[model samples]
Each structure stands twice: as C-alpha cells, then as structure tokens.
Target: MKIATYNVNGVNGRLPVLLRWLEEEQPDIVCLQELKAAQDNFPEGAIRNLGYDVVWHGQKSWNGVALLSRVGKIHETRRGLPNDPDPSQSRYLEAAVNGVLIACLYLPNGNPRPGPKFDYKLVWFDTLIDHAATLAASGAPVVLAGDFNVMPAERDVYKPQRWVDDALFAPEVRAAFFRLLDQGWTDALRTIHPDETIYTFFDYFRNAFARNAGLRIDHFLLSPALKDRLVDAQVDRQVRGWEKTSDHAPVWIVLADR
Candidate 1:
C-alpha cells in the first residue's frame, strides 16, 4: 500500500493543491502536518468528498496533524503527546489505519537556538521517543511519518553550516532523531535510497525550491517488521514549486502487501 506524509502549510489556503494531490496520488493512507487551522475550520466535507476518512488534531494558525485512510476506520490513539510537562502546542496525533499504526507529527521549527523554543523541541523529541518505545513494544507494524523538522545529517541539508545554529540541525536534535532509529524504526526513505542525496523540504525564501536547495526534514520511519516489505520511496519535489505551494513537499513510501 502507498503511505504518504505531507505538510500542507495551511488546510484552508491550500485546499485546491491538496485535493488535487489526493486525487492524483491516491495513497491508501496519508499523514498530514501543519494544517494551520482550528478543528472547526478543517474542510471536512471537501476531504470526505475525495472518498477518504480523516481524523485530525488542529490548532489556530500554527501546528496540527491529521490522518486520512481509505482502507479502514481511522482509529485515533492519542491527540497530543501524552505526559508532556507543558501543554501548549498541538503538534502530534496518533491513529491506526489499515492495520498499521501511524503517527502524524509537526515537530517544532525551533529557530534562534539556545532558547526556550529549542529546549521545548528537545523535550518534545524525548516525548516522541518514549512513545516510539511503546509502539515498538506492541510489535505492530508502525509507520511514524511527518515533518519531523530535523535534518538527519549534513547531507540532508543544502548548507549544513548555515543551519548549524538552527534547532532543526542542532546537535541535540540530530541525537534525538538517531535515538528513535536506535529504538528499531527504519528510516524508510534513507533505507531504500541509502545514497544520502534526497530532500523533502525547501525554504520558500531565496528561491530554495526553484534552485533545488532543500532539506530532508520530512520522513517516513517504519518498524523493522515492515523493512523487508519496503518497495518504493520518493520525495515529490515538483509539488513544492506549484502555485500557492507549501514550503514542504510530499514524501511517499510503498510497501508490499503482507
């Protein structure tokens, strides 16, 4: 089945581009981040008309997450990161679709490092790592996919040095991402294409997308049980340059039928 992750930037503003993508890609399941809308503003009817079921956790003008499944009932497992000390941002949501556990997350883009925002980013990562441990223990085929807001390695970014002070590439952030993989989840895109020359996001500024200057912050991580079934993986870079497009693009992974 095809599973895809996309950060639409804003659900209302990008409805046309998003719906077109859904109709074209036709993924069995989709995990969306950065809906940037309130629960009541989520364009439910528009998506429902596309023949998919959705479960979303939304906030006003910032972070949000959603799961759309065409194969089974979208079972919401959790809304925000449970047990978090602070309760401010709506950045995570978990659900089960088509017998696979899925998580849609919009990890904080902690800019201006050495500050509270960056600290929160690290704390959030810890929370997600804890959640990953629980999912691993369940022995289910888990697919944690979304805009992690992390550049896994220097190669994942255009100029690593330029973003050195940014939270996305901060040493602490990279370590947290590695910790998740150490917990037994395979980085699907990196796994199938281990060459280390792929990207999933680009800054709208500085003609990043036009020049193909991008970062691979978006990801699809799979459980080891689903590793061998990995068939295809790619970043749909073309979507990033479309009219009224988001800074991020779609990342997709296809798995063999069990």
Candidate 2:
C-alpha cells in the first residue's frame, strides 16, 4: 500500500498543481492539509473526476484537513482531537481506509514566541499527545501523517541555530513531539533514511528551493502494529519547485500487504 501526505496551502488555488501531482503519483491514499477553503468550497468534483474518494473538514481561509483513498471506502473515525484546544480551527481529520486508521493533521504555525499563540501551541501539543496515547495503546495499524509544524530534531532544520528561537524549533515543542513518539510510533521517513539530509518544505522567499534551504516538518508516524510493514518512504522534493506550487512537498510511504 502507498500512502502520502501534502499541505496544499489552498485547495482551490492549488487544484491544478494538486491534480497534476495526483496524476503523476497515484498513491493509494493521501492525507491533505491546509486546504484554506470553506466546507462548501472544496473542489470535490475536480478530485472525484480523478477517480478518488475524499472526506474533508474545512474552515474558510485557514487550517483544514482532508483524506483521499482510491484503494477502498473511507470510514471516517474522527474530525478533531479528543480535547482540541482550539476546536474552531479545522486541523484534524481521521478515518479508516484499507484497514488502517489514518490521521491528517495541520499543527499550528504558532509564530511570535512568548505569546498566547505559542502557549496555545503547547497546550494543543499536549492534547495531541493525550489522544495519541489511546491510539497507540489500541494496537491498531494506525498512521498519523501531516504537516506537524515542528522540526523535532536539529537535523530537520537547514540551519538549526537560526531557528532555535522560532516556535517551530522551540525546545518545548520538540519535546512534545518526542513524547508522542515514545508511545511506540515510528517516524517512518527518518527510520528509513536516517543519515540523509532530506527535506519536505522550503520557503517561497529568498530562493529557498533553489538553494535547498528547506525543513522536514511534514511526517508520517506509524503505530507499533504498522511499523513492521514499512518498506519505503520518499519525499517528492522537486514538486516544491513547480510553478505556483505549495512551499511544502508531498511525502509518501510504501508498506507490505497485511
């Protein structure tokens, strides 16, 4: 099975680029973040025309998440965290597809440290940690994939020192991410390509893509029951260079059949 995650930034604005990539990759399942569209604004027809089934949770002009599965039916499991600090924000969507519990999330950017937004980020992280524990304990084949908005390790950032003060790299945030991993979820990409300097996002400014100044913020965390099936993981790195494309790239993982 092949599953992928991408932060499209805006669903309608990036429909062309999205459809193009979907055509090229044809992953069995896709978890999309940052739709930036209202519930009624999702480009369902465009995607359905491509022969995929989609379920989305949207909020106008802000965070949103969606799931696409071409392999089989998508049984929606949840739309947000058990105690999401900010339920008003459409940040999470979960479903059962092809026998795996898939979670699509878009963590807060939480810019400008030492402020409410930053505090909210931490609280939200704790909520996610709490919810993840239940999923981890369930021992189901679960895969949490999305733009987590944190660089968990120094190696995940292009220039670690420069971002130390940034919310995404704040020590507290990284620790929260590790706390979730401690529940037995494997970081698929890092586990497969550990010493490689791989990245999935680049700033649109300063020619970041051309210079390869990027960050690995998007991720796929596989539950203990699913980790052993991990066979391959990859980032569609060049997609970030495409015209009018999202700063983030698509990431995918291949798994052995159950």
- Give the best candidate by TM-score: 2
**lDDT tens digits, residue span 25-91, model 1:** 8999999999989988999999999999998888998888899988889989888887864656778
What candidate 2 gets wrong by more than 4 Å, as runs, is none
Q: Give the Cα error of residue 172 in candidate 1, in Å.
A: 0.7
> lDDT of each structure?
0.88, 0.94
> Between which residue pairs do clashes occur in model 2?
none
For model 1, the run of ten residues with the poorest summed lDDT:
81-90
Q: Top model by lDDT, which number?
A: 2
Candidate 1: misplaced stretches above 4 Å? none
Q: For residues 72-170, could you state the per-residue lDDT of candidate 2 as single tens digits?
A: 989999999997888999999999999999999999888889799999989988988898999999989999999999998988999898998899999
RMSD of each: 1.0, 0.6
State residue 138's C-alpha deviation in candidate 2, in Å.
0.4
